[model samples]
Target: MAWWKLHKRDKPGGPAAGGAVLASAAIITRDQVRSVVGRRQEWQAQGWDFYRTVPELKSGIRWAANGLSRARLYVGRIDPDGSSAPVPVDAQGGDMSPAMVANLLAPLEDLAGGQLGQSEMLRRLSVHLDIPGESYLVGFDDPASGERRWLVCSPSEVTSTGSGGTIRVQLPDSQSARIELSIDDCTLIRLWRPDDEYGYLPDSPLQGLQDPLRELQGLTAHVLATVDSRLKGAGIGLMSDDVTPASPQQSDGPNPIHSDPVTASLIDAASASLKNRDSAAALVPLLLRVPGSVEDKFKWFDFAAQLDEHLLPLRESATKRLAIGLDTPPEALTGMADVNHWTGWLVSDTGITMHIEPKLGLICDALTTQYFRAAWEALGIPDPENWACWYDTSDLKQRPNRAPEAAEAHARGAISDAAYLRELGFSSEDMPDEEEQRRRLLIQLATTNAQLAPAALEALGVQLPDVGQAIATDAVRAPVEISRAEPAIEAPPRNEPPALPIAASAVLDDGWRMACLDLAARRALARAGNWLLSRSGRSRRGELGHVPVHEVHMHVSPDQADLAQMLDGAYRDFHAATPGETDLHAAVDLYVRRLLLTGIAHERGLLAGHLAAAGCDRAAA
Candidate 1:
């Protein structure tokens, strides 16, 4: 939905009173605002966590498209001041090495393919990775002054992409660069290659620029309102003049999976259904990831959405659900006295943003999966099928002498959630029921869930309605096939050796295809003899199977690292010097550069019989 249309708090100016049209998809929840307005409040209070509501789908268009279009960014001395001059993003004679530049461009490549821009784009800079206090410097060649200056990547852009993946941005080229980009799980850690014409080069800065915050130019109010806020609220303090607008050289090119007839039709149908709302632009991309990311971690991208999220809480019983990640620290839940209640939130560096609303139906299965895991472990439930019994509650609660109305919920032969009890099974009649006791029990029918959350609306004192429409309705009939997935079966070892993924030039039909196969063969060679026997091989392609141009790298160094670091820094300079890259395509290019530097692609070629084969021969010798 449009940022203006989403839930807005009543401010002195009114809902979106000062918001400009350029602020289209950008919207923060009242809770997020409450963070800036109420920072020191000490989430020390019970259930006082936070979450930044991300758009269901956001494109990484160049930052300039929005009100921040005029924003000027620069290298820094640090702080909110214009004390530093804008950095020069180019080197006169030194060329960054191609390999290092490839490392830098990995993440940018992903950005281009994914369709992110400006506020929309930067909002996700650190989505998958985090490297606080680290920075990348760019040397710009000032054509007019003939002076070179250096700019440091601000905290806003240097944030992380979770999963240790790259940022995916394209390298700076004079418009005609033929860079095709796509992401594959294996390629994530390898260096990417752009079209042959363009080459990588490296250069270092002679000096650094001043921090933009020091300039504060008419932004004292915003800065103070935002000083303590971390990366999340950083952009808020920025005036339209403060942000470094996205260069169009960045953006994810186009949807490749959307080309599939079934997938394409699904997106088209979904698009046709919601054509009336312009803000629903990202819906298509959100749906496409289910079929994309070969690695399930990529599925987290979908969790970064709003549509399915908003409706999740509503689909289940109002009873609270509790979730505890094995990795979460007890410190995170400091003041939360009641740990049994249902709690969900978006996790990130700034902090956790708790989701207060009920979830929709689509995500119910996912939630059940997460929480039921705890249940399965609690009871001696050997198999998942045994856990299936937990979802049905009728058996424990139903008994003789119960009024017809009492049995109405289960009378239809549905697998009612004996919502009445779980783990510690209990029945009304067995406990010598009384009307008053039953009334109290009626109010909290699902005793099993009591352990799951506060007893009532008044109990925890959460400000939601008590006697209202039932939050979750009766379970519906299954429309689609609901077959349970089989457990992963292990593959038995085989004695046969592996073969390279090869291409008959005629069968390949194109150089790109030939290139992909050649790369695959090279990969096989790299990993040959490293394994025992038979192995499976896979290939990744973008658009019509062409290698995209972009890179992403994650590392912290004083000035530079090795050959790769020098090159990544060089091309990052190239992107800053170039302009007009605020789109999904450019985001991919940027990722590409970083990916190359990180050496994610270069490693993919070492799977079987390729360059990584020496080890097997060594073992035999």
Candidate 2:
């Protein structure tokens, strides 16, 4: 049998012999679990080390780290109804006491591990979280204070039960003493990320990506190996034609036409000399004496080759594949030139929002459940279940490359000016104080009033107070008398109509206007119905007007009143959310477009119904 072929065969229709043999064997064992852990440890170490050398992996991990580094922690309460309320810090003069939330934040800011800062710790954890899809965060309680502190543990240091519900942690000590922890142990933080199936073991983001990553790695190694081999093996091969000695040398017979051995030795020496030459000339020439009358020929060969043109694109494809597997944008991974700056920002923001933040959120949730519950219980707080630990992700919620969007929103009254200012990069401290803001608002209001007063008086045909005379009494601050007398200003020509003043109550709320428009629409619908009924009568030929045998088109054309009513309805529906009255002509034009479409539909429906009835009547006849 061939090496690949099985030595034994089952029945033709039965399972494969090898598969049966494997199925009969035990799948899970203590050694197998340990071996799997060993493999994971190996992969983690290799993956981390590889990140430094691989640009794609480095970019992906750095992107995730930079995105998560912006996280701000906040202590908050999860209500019984699943709503959350932030428990404010007392340092900021919040209602809640500082002691309540400080316990959680303190340990987070100062983890038990090495001298790594909080940002550094998160960056490391984020890398492991993304690459491995799981990480173990071990907590150690203070011996005297009993406060909880955390240390990030390698996956290899932790072992799990068969069901994976319990974990055994090996302390990083000389003896490596181990401790068993239950599934709910607050000291153990297990981050399990499963894509489709739920299990204690999580699938890595690099799982499906390994093939492409390894391919890229292999291509890189091949390039390096080729370069190394080329540099080490680079040299020219020498070729010479065979020559025959004329005769043996007799010392005194004109060197007796050098013998073959003597000539060979001389040629070898000449070749070595040529190789050792270090002259400034571009080419070195060598002359060798031979024992034969035949001319000697020396040929030199070059060492070089044309590289494969397809390798660049193939390597790029592999990089893009790996990036896709990591949920990272190709432009981010490869610095793809085809992607514009705005597009790259959008793509990066999407990856951060949809993939990166959620992973960090999972870590936050685990920490919250473990630390917040314990801290609240230690503080004699009741129903600690309502409280959870969370990070502030408000900065990440902003739309990338859309700072102008905030300004537009402010202009539209969708957001406050303070929020707009913040979006524009002004910190809370940079904003004007409340007192200064109040003074600014007063000045703005006064200026607005001054600007509008002249327009209001002009509309009423009242002239402004003579500012020249008022300036004389400016020192006394006396009010100027209004001029009731009609000014010498000539009225508009008779051909030009005078503008009419609008009433104060001209502006109506949406609901009231919509109701009036609805009433008008209902009346129009009633009139249309009556008109359609009136058309169903005896024709001039004394036959049913709507009979199909007559073959007359039964189309309902809209009248001027009907069209006007529909325009009003469309106008009301379009501006249903408007805060006040709008320009009548503009509103009518906007509504007429929509009214024409709907009116056509309504007429078609009525005509179709009438035609169907007429067809049935004709068929009965």
> On residues 181-292, what C-alpha lDDT tens digit does candidate 1 reach at each position?
1211111111111123443211001001011111222133344333322211111111222223222222256744354454444444444434533333323332222332
- What tens-digit string does per-residue lDDT give for candidate 2 at 474-498? 3112112111132111124435532
Model 1 local distance difference test score:
0.25
Taking all chains together, the TM-score of candidate 2 against the true structure is 0.50
lDDT score for residue 611 of model 2: 21
Q: For every model in order, what is the number of clashing pairs?
A: 192, 0
- Which one is best on TM-score? 2
lDDT at 442 for candidate 2? 60
